[model samples]
Target: MSGAPIWIGAAHCVSALGEGPRFHLQRMRDGGTALRTVPGLTAKPMFAGLIPDELLPAGPRRIQRLLDRCLLELLDDLKPRPHERWLLVVATTKGDIAAMEQGDAAASALPLLGEHARQRCGFGAQPLVVSLACASGTAAFILACSAIEQDRYDHAIVIGADALSRFVLEGFASLYALDAVPCRPFDAHRAGTTLGEACAAVAISRDRDRIPEVIGRWVAGSIAHDANHISGPSRTGEGLLRAVQNALRIADLRASDIAAVNAHGTGTAYNDAMESIAFERCGLSDAPLSGYKGWFGHTLGAAGLLETIVAVQALREGTVLRTLGLSEPGVPGRVNAISADAAVPGRMLLKTSSGFGGCNAAVIIEAES
Candidate 1:
């Protein structure tokens, strides 16, 4: 965690709970879920965490509106020169799928969203888009760090988002992966994930002079894939175990140094069990850990970025969030799971995410002293 810090620059978000990163933190602290029962694509009611209809404009391009709001605020905070080497990176699973679902014949170009972001934000560097199933958000942040470290760009604006669409809801529902009620991560009686929508962003740069404010450095990140199943995580937690260990090693810290763990905790049966095994193998058995899915539902690509943003605030304020729906520790591994929020003793936070196609990513965020 040493060396010239890659300034956090700025970060923002819009979720069901509300707008802004800090607002989401306080809402979570209030100890209630923002998700509610909504009619499914059909008449059947299902739990989902959706952005309030009022927060969104009356329009078809809702994804664009959500992302623009975040990027607009981020660029305003950084106040970069028009010619600055700023890159726009977009992370999403179903990029503007609404247009396609609405019968727009020309919406198949997936990278169109990122390019639009670059133009909207006036970025000087070409945009990069990533779609790694649910791990897309964290992977985008990790890529931003690598690009900055390699001098490919002076600053990186990584924004990730996905909205609930008929295609996505039916897809998960067909697979029987969605819960009838709100998703509960790591809870013994947890059923499955409830779909949600969110847009989140973070700015990263090596030059502190260009950043208005510093958010802690992104110390280390690692991504691994077990290739065990296309839509399922490795039953043995093989990929996640390696990802966490490698992330700790890259941060040059042992397992004990991590003050808390912000796990993906999608509330699915296999995913929860796999994360527990991975944490135990990483020797992070005693670290306080909880998942944010219960609060925000599974926002898919937006999940990791939204969670990471809130985690930065948590580490800075020395707070550890409780697993909202977790009453009994029921994962297979011996990892420590907290039911009630507590104070954190250290500054480093280990953030991990696992997604379909066996993708697993671990990122370490350190709070500035």
Candidate 2:
């Protein structure tokens, strides 16, 4: 399986925007967002991106509910034939943290969360959970690609989810990272990120011919760490630059081949500036760029997969989405942040994410040309 191309058989994301990828895409096309004022885990009301009340599960196990809804829909929508060897990889930042706050002894553990998802989805084995902050979802893709290259499984399902919990909301508030209103990524007046929650998944396989549909081929990806700070990004954007450069080397592509860039734009002052410096250093300043944080806030663990699904759809549709909250470019570098949905002449997409602890990841996906 070394030279085999990993095919994305199916993709689905459940966010405040909608239940499926196409539905979410349509909502974006309509220029609508799910951001609104919601009661926080604390006493104050905070702006958040939440799944519609009508779509939420009625029972307990809040985090499990999101994963179950996503997987069940993927199973029904894709209808992939039963494969004997299938691997399940779950990406999450804080799993069942709310339960932990309520004194559930093992609720916050990764293994427990993985086991619950495995049982609900009826997978052959327990899931391998990735918890690398915001990079967890893209990191899962990197793992799946490697596993397929090593012939470890016939197919892999990577699901990323994080629900709005008391612990997480209060934690961000403590850091003073919340913006009072909707966040404006890459804007001159940008302040901070609005925390978001979502569950998203993609099915990939080495056997291209067996896939029900091919959204795109996973060409290459890489992750790097700058170790600059425990929670802050490198001032020079070193980690992201190396990650993008390494990914291009693996994919046999240059910066000019990329048609559009789906950035990890968290709308933070430092994070946005870091990305601007990175793209300029990597010679991608001219590439159209936008952040999805404005659309669904920062979905923490789900950001990578959630943004990838949206970017893939944009590539297929021959368009690039506007950075929702962008007004004037604030970064020092020549970052080409889009103000409206624009057309792209090429199908190649470079999607990147950065997270706490100086972690960075990037992946290249292209339309089936």
Candidate 3:
């Protein structure tokens, strides 16, 4: 199949590292992390990369307000053509759960998010919401690209947002996946993951001249289900390996063309081990790989896009940041847990992500001249 050119015009992110691409790049370069313990979260132990209370909106209406803030900033930066109709794709695993936990006022207010955007920003297009567990963000991007390729729309704005919630916190804690300290992905002493809350939006278009091109193209991506477990990944890494191979095949690229890999390292015993095995099976064991979960914790649905933005920035800057807390390899594979800056002048980057419900997705992005 011939690939359609989809340009990432602008990306805006708010995470533990900070806001915007520059803030995240600077923080990664400085090697700083902001994972902290959220007091009274639960007795099971938990760490979260939370947006500062001062920065978060007050009350149950906060998430919608915060999402609006981020989306508006992205739209302002792009200032897309006035005559063009945009397709807004919003992805989230936990949409305003915190607000719902607060009761009726918050629950009722959450669904109004889409209408709020249309009325407030005059988007003039209907918004679509996608909630496919943790893979929601990346899947949203794929959907946008497919829509454009099929001539469903000329442009699509993808936004991913999730707020911290006690329900999710307790659920993961019940699974014993909450780390007491900052997460250490692929480390010998790795425990589990930390939670994080943030919102990110990326504007993609067919107009290449208006976008900031990065190394590699988003040629192809796929989503698959293990169908074996609800929360646990398949032991053989079957689903993940298949997704990677399918993405590479669809892109008409080989594993050798991929210069680096942004792994879906959640620091859990099962996830880390499975991903390592998958990479080796996919013939990517020798490729330099790293995880951003340690830097921003696992932002759930927002993680895919947030990490994609990070990888794009790395390609643009020609340097890969060390995995923040990785120390001493643990998984039984050839996965390199290297620290320090590494120059990645290669032509392609293969980015992968996996989530609960046994869902996995991978996208190959290339730099454009």
lDDT of each model, Cα atoms only?
A: 0.85, 0.86, 0.78
Candidate 2, which ten residues in sequence have the lowest lDDT sum? 75-84
Full-model lDDT, candidate 1: 0.85
TM-score of 3: 0.93
Q: In candidate 1, what are the lDDT values of residues 252-343, reduced to their tens digit?
A: 89999999999999999999999999899899999999898888788888888999988878778888888888987788999888888889
122-198 per-residue lDDT for model 2 (tens digits) = 78666799999999999988888778878888788889999987688778888888888788888898888998889
Clashes of 1: 0
Which residue ranges in model 2 land beyond 4 Å of their true spot? 78-83
Error of 1 at 213 (Å): 3.8
lDDT of 2 at 310: 86
Q: Supply every candidate's count of residue pairs whose N, Cα or C atoms clash at under 3 angstroms.
A: 0, 0, 8
> Could you estimate the TM-score for every candidate?
0.96, 0.96, 0.93
TM-score of 1: 0.96
The stretch of ten residues in a row with the least summed lDDT in candidate 1 is 1-10
